[model samples]
Target chain A: MTEKDFELAGIRTVEEQPLRAKRKWYKEYPVVSMLFLGIMIVECFFCEQIMTVNPTYMDLEHCNVAPGRKFLFGTDTLGRDIFSMIWYGGRVSLLIGFVATAISTAIGVLFGAVSGVASPRADAFLMRAVEIVLSIPNLLMIVLLQAVLGGAGVIGISIVIGITGWMSIAKVVRTEVRQIRNSEYVIASKCMGGSFWHILWRHFLPNFWPSIMFMVVMNVRTAIVAESTLSFMGIGLPLEIVSWGSMLALSQQALMTGSWWMILIPGCFLIVTLMCVTDIGNSLRRDSNQRQSNL
Target chain B: MSEILIDVQNVTHHFKLNRKTAICAVDQVSFQIKKGEILGLVGESGAGKSTLARCIMNLYQPTAGRILYKGIDTCDRRQFKEHKKMLQTKRQLIFQDSTSSINQRMKAVDIIAEPLRINHVHTPRGSARAEAEFQLHYVGMDAGCLDKYPPELSGGERQRIAIARALSMEPELLVADEPIASLDVSIQAQIINLFKHLQKEHGFTFLFISHDLAMVEYLCDRVGVMYQGRLVELAPTRDLFSNPQHPYTRTLLSAIPLPDPKRERNRRKGVYDAQKS
Candidate 1:
C-alpha cells in the first residue's frame, strides 16, 4: 500500500476501537441523561417564544386574570403572559450563563496551560498574578467592572462575568497542567524533539479536558446567578427585558396586593433550571472522580 | 574489539536547588559502549547510574561535557533531528519500572509502535500491527496481547512488553536501565536470560544499568563500577568482580551473600565489614 493509504488504514484501525469502557452509572441511571437532555430541549424551544411576547404589552381588559384557557400561566401585573415572559427571560439567563462561561474557560485554559508548562520564572510570575486575581471577591470584581463599563446590559454583564469567572478556571487548569507536565508521555515527547506547541496540543490539552469540563459546568451556574443578582439590583439589561430577576423586582409591590403569580412563576422556573444544571454538574463531577480513581 | 558506538565523555549533571545547595547527580562520568557489546553499569541506590543513562539519552541535559554517537555530539538538536531516524532506529531504552514507563491508556500494540510512530518510521509503511506482532512474538508474546492494556499484565509480562517495545525500534544500542528491578526474583532470571538471548540474536550493543551486581556480572561482557556519581573502576565482568580496585567496588562485591547456606552463615560475621571494605 501507498504511505498515505497505510497511514489511513492504521488510523482507521486504531479509531475503530472504543476509547473508554462504558461506565456502570450511565447504564444504571439512564434517566439522568434523559432528564438533562429533555430540559435542554425544552429550554431551547421556550426561549425563542419568550422574546416574541411583548413583556410590556398591557391588556387592561384582561388585567388580574387568573389561570384561564387563553393564558395557561395567567397574566402578570403588567397584563402580559407570565409564561411568555419566563420563556424570554430564561433565554437571556441561559445565554448569558453559557456564553460567559465558555469565554472564561477558553481564557483560563490558555493562560493556565502557558503558565504551567513554561519555565520556572514564567510560572512564578503567572501564578502570582493568578493569585492576586483569585484573592479578589468575584462578585465585587464583577460589580466594579460593570460600573466602570457604564452599562449593566447583556453585553456589559457578560463581559464582566466572563473576565472574573476565568480566575477560578485558570487556577484549576494551572494545577492540572502542573501535574500533567511531569507525566512520562510529556517527557517522552520532549525527548522525541517535539516542540512546545506540539506537546501542549497533543499531550497537555487532551488531559486537561476533564477538568475544563468540570469548570465549565460549575461556572455556568455561577454566571447565571451573578447575572440574576445584577438584574435584580436594577443594573443588568434594559428595563424592558423580562428576566426572572426583573420579574422579582417588579413583584415586590404586587406581593402586598396578593398578586402572587407575578413572582412565584418566574421564581419557580429559575429554581428548577438551576437545580437541573447542578444535578448534571454533580453527575459529571462523579464521573470525573470515578475515572481518576480507576486510573 | 567492536567499533565504539556511543562515547559519553566527562559528563557532569547537577540538580541545583536555589543558589547554595546543589546535588551533583552524575559527576564527570565517562564510559563507552562498543558496537554489539553488552556493558553493565552496577552501583548502589544513590550511585547516579540511571542519571548517567538519562544524560546519554539526552533526556536530561548535562551540566558539562559531551555525549557522542559515532564520535558526533548527540546533544545538538539540529544534528539529533537530522539523524532522527538513525537515533530512533539505532537506540532504545528499557526503563526500571515497566508498568509506569509505558502509557497505561495505550494498548500493547500502540505502546510497542510508539517509537516507530514518533520517529515517523511507520509513515511510509504503516504496518504497526504487523511490526508490533512480530516484536511481541520475538519477546514470547502473541497477537492476543495486542488488545490488552498495561494494567492487565503481570510485572514480568509488563517488562517483557517493555523490552519488546524497545527492541521493535531496531535499535543498535539498547539502554536497559534496571529492566528487571521491579520483577519477582524468579522472573528476574527469565528477563535477564531474554536480554542475553536478544543481544546475541540481534547483535545489538547494550548499556545495562542496574543496582544488582550479580545480575550485571552474569549478563555483561564489560562491567563498570559507579560510586557517588563517579565511575571508579571498569573492566571485564569477571575481572572486575575477582580483582576490584575501588574500595567501594570491593565493599559492594564482598557484601553479596554466597549461594550456599553454609558459606553465607560463615560470612555473616564479616558481611558488614565487607560492606565497608
Candidate 2:
C-alpha cells in the first residue's frame, strides 16, 4: 500500500484500538481487579476489626493450630492468627508501594520532560545527572537511606524508595520526548511560534500518554516489590510497623522449627497482590503498545 | 510589483551535526520577491528550497546574513520577536507533508483557526470558529469539515485545510514549500489552480518551492533554479524555460516529459546529462 494508505490505516488503528481494548480490559480484568482492589482497600481501613482474633491479642491457648475453624489459616507459634497478620501486613506493603510509585512518577515526569525538550547542552547535563543517580545500586542505596534516617518508619522508607526509583521512568519519558521533538506536528507547532509549554501540552504529552501509562503501571510493580524486598532484608520498615516484609523478616527463625504459617501466609498475600498488579500493568502495556505502533 | 515584499541577502545556514562537524545547507543565497508576484524556486531534492523558505519566514536562524520584511531586519536580535509576530500575522507557510503539518489530535476547524487563536485575531473566541469556517470555505471545503480530525481526512482534503489555515491569517505573503509534492497529479493540479486563483484575486505575493518545473512554469512570474546549495540561475519563467542558461537548469527542464505520447516517445533526442555538462 502507499504511504497515505498506511497512514490512513494507522489513524484507524489508533482511533479504534483504544475503544476496543478498553472494552476488553473491563470485560477481562476490571471486575477481577476491582474485587482484588476492594479486598485491599477493605483491609486498609478495617484490618484491626476484621481480624476477628486480633493479631495483638495473642491466644497462647490455641498455639500451633493449623487451618482450623476457630482460627482460619491456622494460628502462629505465638498463637496470633496468621490470617489477621496477612491482612494487616498488606496495609503497609500496598501503601508503601502506591505512595512511593506516585512520588517517583511525578519526579520522573518533570525531570524527563525537561531533559527531553531542553537544548542539547541542557539535555546532556540533565541526562548525565540522571545517569549518575541511576549508576548507584537501588537496594544498596535504600539500605543506606534507612540506616541514615534511623528507622524513619513507613513514611521515610517510602520517600527513600520514591527518590531512588524515578530514574528509569525519567529516562523513558526523556527518550520519548526527544522522539516527539522530531515529529512533524512538533516542527509545525514550532513554526507556528508555539511556546515550550504549549508544545509540551498539545503535542508531546498527548502522544506520550500511552507510554507514560505503561511506565506508571510498571513502576507501581517495582516500588511494591522493592518495599517487600527491603522488608525481607530487615532494613526497609521500622520494627514496630507490621508489613509483609517485616513479617517475612520475623518468620526466618520460625521456618527452621517448621511453623510455616508466619512465613507462608504473608508470602502468599504478597505473591497474589503482586500478580494482580502485574495483570493490570500487562493490560496497560498491551493498550499502549497498540496505540504506539499505530503512530 | 514595484515594492519589494521579501528581501533575502547573502544568507547561509550551516547546521552543526556534532561538536566537530558542520554542513552548509544554504550558501550566500540572495533573492527578492516583489509584491503580487509568485517567485518559484525549483531544485533537486537536496537543493535547499525548503531551507530558504524557512529562513525567509524566520522559522530558522541563518548562520550568516539577514532577511528584511518591509525593510525591518528580521534577524536583528532585539527586533526578532517583534518581527516574528508581524510575520506570523502578515505572512505564513504551508508545508509539503499535509499530515505532518496538521496536528492529528485537532479538528479541522481548530487546526485552521489555531493561528487566529494564538494571535488573538478576533475579540471573542466564538468568532474565531466563524473565521475558521470562512477559511475552510475559502479553500473549497464545506462546513461539515469543521469537526473532522486530520486523521479522518484525505491527503488532498488535509492540504486544503492547511491552505485554509495559512490563508485564514489573510497574509500578504505565503511561502508554499512543496505544497503539492505529496498529492496525486490530479489533486496537485487542482491545488495549484486554487493557489493561482487566490493569488490573482488577492494579489498575494508567493515564494513557491517545488521540484516540479512544469508546475513552477505554470504558476510563477519568475523562477530561480538552484543546484546543491546555490542558485544556479534565475530569470522570468518564460526566459528560463525557453532559453535556459544554467546547465543544471537545462538538466532539470529536459527531464520534463511532453504530454503527447507521440512527441514524448521521441522527446529523448538531446537529453541534458549533468556529467557531460
Candidate 3:
C-alpha cells in the first residue's frame, strides 16, 4: 500500500490462481437426493439383471392371483407378475424419456446458441422456424407420423417425441444466450481482447449451463408423459414389451373386472418418476437463481 | 517539455436512441493527455463522461475524428481486427461496477488472470496464480479472497479484483470511468489513494473520470469538465480551481460543500441545469 508496506510485503504482480477445490454433488445433496437416487439405481440394477422372473413371461397357474409371497403386486389376467411388469415397464419408459430429452436438448441448444449469436436476419429466420415447429400440434403430429411408420420401434418413437419437443427448449436457450451475449461481462471480455468464440465458450456456456440442466430435466418429464400418451393410443412401443402406457392401456378393460392393481401399480411408478424429475429440475433452477440474488 | 501520450482530434460518437433519431453521446470532444499525467474527466451521470472514456478505450469506434495513442492511430478503421488487437492490451478501462463487469461464474483469481492469460503474459497455470495473488496484494486484497466468486465478495473487493485484472496487463494507459462510483464514500477515498499510488509507481497515463470535483482536484494533474457530451473546459487542477472560466465549471465548483456550515452558507449560488442545453 505504501513504500514502507511494499518493503515489508515483497510482492508485486498478481498471478493467475488455479480453480478452487469444488465439492461433489453427492456431498451437496447428501440426505434426500442421495438416498432417493441410490434406491432408484439399486432397483434399476435389480430389475435389469438380478431379477429371475421375466416381466413378459406368463404363467397360467398365477392367473387371478393377488399380492402374496410369490408376486408382490399380484398377477394380471394373462398371469404376469405385476411387480416385474411395473419394473420393466418403468425401465423402458424412463429410458425413452432420457433418450428423447438428450436428442431434443442437443438439437435445441445448438440451434439456440447459433441463432442467439448469429446475425439479426439469421436469428429472425431461425426463430420463425421454431415458431412454425411449435405451431404444429405435438401429440397429433407424433401420432400421425408414427401411424405412417406403423409398428415403429422404441428408437423411432423416441426420435418422434424428441422432434416435437425441442421447439420450446430452443426458444429458451436462444433467449438466454442472447441475454448473456449482451451482458456487461461479455463486453468486458471483448475489451480484454478475448475472441468471440472464447467468450461464448468460456463465459456464456458456463453461465447458461444451469438453465440448460433445468430444461433437460423438465424435457425428460415432458418426454415421458408424451411417450405414455402415444403408447396409451397403442401407437408407441411394441406390444411384446411392457411399458407404463401399454399397461395402462391393457388395464382399461381390466378396470371393468375390478383388478385395480393392474392399473394402479404401473401408474404409481409413472407418477413418482415424473415427480422426481420435476423436483430435481426445481432444485436446479433454485440453485442457479440463488447464486444471483442470495447472499 | 511533457510529450503528448494521447491525442484526440474531435472524437464524436453517436448512438441510435431509437429508430428515428440518433443522439450524439460524445459531441466532437477533443482533449490531450500528457505522458505519466493523470487527466480527470468530470461530469454528471449522463454528461457522456463514460462514453468519452469508452471512446478513448476504443471500445466504441468514434463516429468521426481520430484518437492517437503514443502516435499510433488507435481509432484507425483500417485492418479493423488487427488494429484493435494491437491496442487492446496497451490501453485498458476499469468499469464502475465490477459485479456487472466481472464474469459472475469466475473466481477472483481467474478474473485477475484473464487479461494476463489472454495477452500471453503468463501461460503457465502456476505463474498465473502467483501473478493473480500478487495483484490482489497490490490492490490491498488478501490471498484468501482469491478463490471467491464476485457474488461471494463485497462490492469493494470485486472492484479491487477488477482493478487488479486491468493492472495485470501492465498497461501503458488506464481509463478508469467512475471506478469508485458504486463504492461506499469511505472506501472511495481509499480507492482514489490506491489509484494515485499505482499511478505514481506504474507511471502510466491515467484518465480518472468522476463527478467528484474535489476528488479530481486531489488526484488529477489536469481536469476536463464535460457537459452534455461536450468538453467545455480543460486546465491544470490548480488553475481550474483558482481561476474557473466556464459557467458550468464555476457552478460545479460552487456546488462542493465545505465542512464549516458558515463557509457552506456563504458558498456561491449557481445551479447549472444540464438539461437546458
- State the lDDT of candidate 2 residue by residue for B25-57, as single tens digits: 898999888999999999989888888888887
User: How many Å off is the CA of B103 in candidate 1?
Assistant: 4.3
Q: B1-277 in candidate 1: lDDT tens per residue?
A: 5699999899999999989999998998888888999999988888799999888887888999899998768787788778866775677777888766776666888777767766667633359888888888988878899999888988988898888878877778888788888888999999999988898999988999888878988999999988888898899988998997777777788789889998888873222233444
Which of 1 and 2 is ahead in lDDT? Answer: 2
Question: Model 3 segments beyond 4 Å from truth?
Answer: A1-38, A45-49, A53-89, A106-128, A144-157, A172-183, A194-215, A239-264, A280-295, B1-5, B18-20, B69-78, B103-106, B116-128, B242-251, B254-277
DockQ of 1: 0.15
Please provide, for model 3 over A1-295, each residue's C-alpha lDDT reduced to its tens digit, 9 standing for 90 to 100.
Answer: 6666656465666798988879775655424643665566467656867454888888888886777888888888888887887767777787788889989988887788889988999999999999987888888889887888777777888888887788877888889899988777777778889976677677877877877788888998999898888778778886677878878877776777788888888788788777777877888888778765764
Candidate 1 docking category? incorrect
> Which tens-of-lDDT digit does each residue in B1-277 have in candidate 3?
2999899999999998899999988998888888899999998878999988888877788999888887777787674455676688878888988788898889988888988767677543359999899889999999999899888898888888889988888888898988998999888988999999999899999999998888899999999999889999999999999999988998988888999999888887799876774
Q: How many pairs of residues collide in model 1?
A: 1
Question: Candidate 2 - CAPRI tier?
Answer: acceptable
Give a tens-digit lDDT track for model 2, residues A1-295. 6777556443554344444334564575556865886688687668878887676566889877777788787876667777887777778888888899999988998799999989999999999999998999988888887788786677787898898899988998899899878776677667667777777777777767777786687777787788888877777775457778877886776777777776788888888777777778787788678766786
State the weakest 10-residue window (summed lDDT) of model 2 chain B. Answer: B268-277
Q: Which candidate number maximizes DockQ?
A: 3
- Give Cα-based local distance difference scores for all models: 0.79, 0.83, 0.84
* Model 3 backbone overlap count: 15
In candidate 1 the C-alpha lDDT for residue B211 amounts to: 83
